[model samples]
Target: MKITNVEFVISAVRPDQYPVDALPEFALAGRSNVGKSSLINRMINRKGLARTSAQPGKTQQLNYYRVNDQVYLVDFPGYGYAKVSKVQRQQFGQMIETFLNDREPLRMVLLIIDIRHEPSKDDILMYDWLKHYEIPVCVVTTKADKIPRSKWDKHVKMIKTSLGFHPADRHVLFSSETGLGRDELWALINTTIEEAKAEAAEAHEAEEAEETAEVSLEK
Candidate 1:
């Protein structure tokens, strides 16, 4: 996670447009105006790499950003924007669901929420979907700088309660403005990638062992 080359790869609306590099990707998901772009920018140490839009639901595509040429941060379209038409929202949901369910390179997802408020209905639904899929996730509560330190624990508890967050799931308090939890988030991402690789390796070994046993029996 050293600071190096950061590039805006593509705005992909379909899997065909997704990057073919096979790099492990961390998908960022959250409601509109929840600071997903700002968190990406902060992680890359860039001021405006990920554009912070004043308009909610402005990003209708999966914006892929390559960090250090190693991992891609896939920013999904922010949900819960009231101005969007029902049809458009349905389309977005299908697009997101397809990626979450089918994307092979997706290692984990970072679901962002505001620290000062209870988790919205949209947030809870997203969390539930991820859990149902057994997708690796890290819940990021942003805007921690706006809240006082003493009350941070209280808000975190409220968020966990509202989302019914699993105790095993990782939760990081973040502040894009202050760089809080940036390092921790990066560490968590790297750890997730490593764990996924280990799991895949174990599965491959098991498959090979099974094949060997079958061959021996045939012999």
Candidate 2:
């Protein structure tokens, strides 16, 4: 996907602040300083569209970025950081839970993790929560270039094992610094978006058929 028009739209903390355009939204979720911002920059081919911060957990809201006016890449606040207050953490958690549970435009979520380490407890829990919601997910392990090419499989295996990776879930090894797996991630996002649209269309058609049948019976 050649991205041309990518722009930071809004930083929304409340549900009412979310974009009304209803574009398919792909969310990025991960622990603090796990390079979620860098992954977004690399994916969009922009240097600073998603700000990389030295202070983890600086993002306290759902940041929405519009791509080609076709979809929105939502950069969620990084979780599991210690610097934030308990109240702040709780607020972030509630915001994220609400969006994931109720948002209609959300198409897929990309759970980012570090390639060099085993998936953290938070990572595992996040993955489980998404699965429980039956939301489509694509696990993205970033900083892949830090690891040796020969050992990539071993690290990926460890992550999968620790997370109890479901067969239906997708996983991709990524390197934000080197643009690795960027194209593949985009492809997955596009495919997920199309599939969601198709499902919605089919449901609409079914409803229409039922309504028509009822109308004929009444007549």
Candidate 3:
């Protein structure tokens, strides 16, 4: 997607603060330092749209971005920051859960993880939670340029297996610095939007049909 316009909509600590416009949203989820902010900047063709840091857990709220006046791209706070205090960690968990479970405009989630290490326990749980909700997900293995080309397949397999990801849900080896997997992700987002549109249409038709039946029975 060519982002013609980009703007910060809000930092939503509460769900009510989310953008009221009915635009499809693609969210990025991951552990701290998983390169999500960098990925968003790369996607939007902006230098610092999402912000970066050597410090982990900088994003504590749902960051919203309006793209090309068509759709919303959300940068969710990464979950597994080691240095976070217990109280802060718990608060982060609540925020994440509220956005995932209650937010209806979310179309798909891109779960980011480091390519060099095994998927952490928090990563596994995040994946499982999305699964339980039947949410469509695309796993992104970041910092792929750090590894040799020969070792790419091996690391991808390790991540999939560690997270118990099925063949149906594949992982993309992403490099924000190199723009790896950018086209593939765009295609995925397009497909998700089409699917969501079809579902919404079907639901609207179903509701109309029920109303018609009620009217005829009352006559």
Candidate 4:
């Protein structure tokens, strides 16, 4: 995707406040301080559009960023922050679950993980939950620049093994500092959006056909 117009749309805590444009949305989920903000900046070729905070669990709502007026990058509240209160964590969980289960425009989720560490228990749980729900997901390993190129494959393998990564899901090794996986991630996003559009179209055709059949029988 070419670099173009991007805007910070909203920080929404409720479904009623979400963007109504119905653009294809790719949600980003990760542990606190996992370089998700940096990844978003790198993806859109911006320096600080998605604000990076030194504090963990700073993002408490779904942050919406509209890209090229064509699609959305929805940033979920960072999970697995030990410092966050139990009530807050539970609230975040409910908010995320609702969106994942009911949001119609969601195309895919980019589950961000730090490449330097093994997948956390929270990471494994989130991945499994997405799998159980049959939601499309792409595992994005961030901060790749911290690891030597030689060790990249080994670390990736370890992470995948820990998470029991799905065979059909995509994984992108990313370095927000170097823009290593930006293009590949965008390609995956574009492909997913197209697939969703096709599915919707097919469903619409099937619905119309059924309606027409009922009309004919009534006549």
- The better candidate by TM-score, 3 or 4, is 4
In Å, residue 72's CA in model 3 sits off its true spot by: 1.7
Report the C-alpha lDDT of model 1 over 85-178, residue by residue, as the tens digit: 9999999999999999999999989999999999889999999999999998899999999989999999999999999999999999999999
Q: Of the candidates numbered 2 and 4, which has the greater lDDT value? A: 4
Cα-based lDDT for every prediction: 0.95, 0.94, 0.88, 0.95
Candidate 2's C-alpha runs over 4 A off are none
Across 131-193, the per-residue lDDT of candidate 2 in tens digits comes to 999988999999999989999999999999999999988998899989999999989988988
Stretches of model 1 off by over 4 angstroms after superposition: none
Find the number of clashing residue pairs for candidate 4.
0
Which segments of candidate 3 are over 4 A away from where they belong?
A: none
Between candidates 2 and 3, the lDDT winner: 2
| Per-model TM-score versus the true fold | 0.96, 0.97, 0.95, 0.97
Candidate 2 RMSD to the correct structure: 0.9
Ranking by lDDT: 4, 1, 2, 3
Deviation in angstroms for 129 in model 4?
0.5
Q: After superposition, how far is residue 219 of candidate 3 from its true place, in Å?
A: 3.3
